[model samples]
Structure formats: structure tokens, C-alpha cells
Target: MSSSSSMNKYWIPHLDIHKKVITQELQFYLGPEATVRSFTRDGEDGFLITTPGACLTDEQIDDICVKSKEMWEKQAAARAAGAATRVLKRPLHQPVVISKAGASESTRRRRESRRSNETRSRRDERRRN
Candidate 1:
């Protein structure tokens, strides 16, 4: 028997058959809008960002491809712009203040006492060894 005998009119034509097969495969596996629905819908390129296996019409797929290309170009341009504005060199070290020149005496005494206690504990451990 001929393969076209039981096929529908849409399935008989080569172009239509291909589209229908793509549509069915996308729908069977990816649902609709096939891997192109996840993209932002704000511009002409939003449809290219869909999850993998999305089912969409041929026109929609074309639109997604076009938009994705545009987005890629824009992203490349932005990256180039940012790279142009960055500083290449950096200082090795930054100075840090140990203590304020005129801090309260009480706080300083408390910190010193805590440090002395820690030092004493370490010395006592060494003696035991």
C-alpha cells in the first residue's frame, strides 16, 4: 500500500507535512511554543527564551530566532561598553586604623584585660605540656 493512501491532505504535501510533523513533535514533547516561550515578550525577540521542546508555528519560530539574534547583539554591545568603563589597576593595600586617638579609657582597659586573660590561658596550657 502507498504511504500517502491513509494520510490526510495536510500530511501529503511536503512543506505542510514537515510543519505538521514539527508541530506534533513539539506538542507531543514540549507542549506549545516549543523552547521559545520562556523569553521576554517585550520585544520581537522574546520568544527565543522558551524552555526546550516548545511547540510553535513556523512564523513564531522565525520571530523567536530573529529576536534572539537581536538580543545577543545588544548583550554583546552592553558587555563591550561595561568593559570600556572599568578600572584596570588596583592598590595593593589599604591602611586601617587600629584605634581612635581619643576613645574612652574604660573601653581600652576592658579590651586589654580580655587580651591578657587569653594570653595567660595559652601560657598555662604550655606549662602543663
Candidate 2:
């Protein structure tokens, strides 16, 4: 499609079958105000759907296209720079801290201390009785 036509329509990249379905769907959903048409560019197929009450001037279209191109270029440049600086190399393997089987040293000590405390309390209770 020509650049002139693109300015006045919302271009949708799709196959022929999808284009028909999308056109019907848009017509159904948007009512009669929506205009759907097929267009070909460099042998690639797509659809151009016109918005309701959309009347953009030639200058406006040119300005939009220019702005879009500039934004796309900026984004592509930023992506390229990011990719170049990125570090692909990772650590050989994940770091894992494996504890010994059963309880850890600190846990065993705490458990033994608790047991002694319980024994002392029971002995004191027996003496009182």
C-alpha cells in the first residue's frame, strides 16, 4: 500500500482468512461506520480498516509517519546498545548450602537445653508434691 493510504487507515497485518473474519467482526462490533479493505504491500497481504469520522490531513499523516520512524529508530538503537553491553556468561552452577543429615549443631544444642529445663521443672514439681 502507498504511504498516502496508510495515513488514513489503521493497517492490520493478517492472512486472507483472518482479514475476512476481522473485517466481519469489526463491522459487526463497530456498526456501518467502520470501512474494511484489503491491501497488498511487496507481495505481503494485510487489511486496512478505516476509523469512524477519521479525516487527517496529508501534513498530519506525514508528521505522524516521521515521528513513528524516529521513535522506532531510537528504540532499536537502545536495544542494540543494551544487547552489546549485556553479560551472557553466568555462574557455572547455582550456589547451594547443604546442611548435614538430621539436625544442625545449633538446633541439637537448643533441643538438649530444652530437655534439661523440662527435667528440672518436673523434679521441682515432684519435690513440692
* TM-score leader: 2
lDDT for model 1, please.
0.48
* lDDT value for model 2: 0.63
Expressed as tens digits, the lDDT of each residue in 9-115 for candidate 2 is: 66655432343345445655445666778877667776666755464345544444555566667779999999998765766565667776557878878989999
Q: Look at candidate 1 and give me any clashing residue pairs.
A: 33-55, 34-54, 34-55, 35-54, 37-50, 38-50, 39-49, 45-67
Where's the lowest-lDDT run of ten residues in candidate 1? Answer: 8-17
| lDDT tens digits by residue: candidate 1, 7-121 | 2221111212223233334344444433322233334222232333323456744544555566667779999998998665664454566767566577898899999999999
Off by over 4 Å in 1: 1-54, 88-129
Q: Cα RMSD for candidate 1?
A: 17.5
Q: Return the TM-score for each candidate structure.
A: 0.30, 0.34
TM-score of 1: 0.30
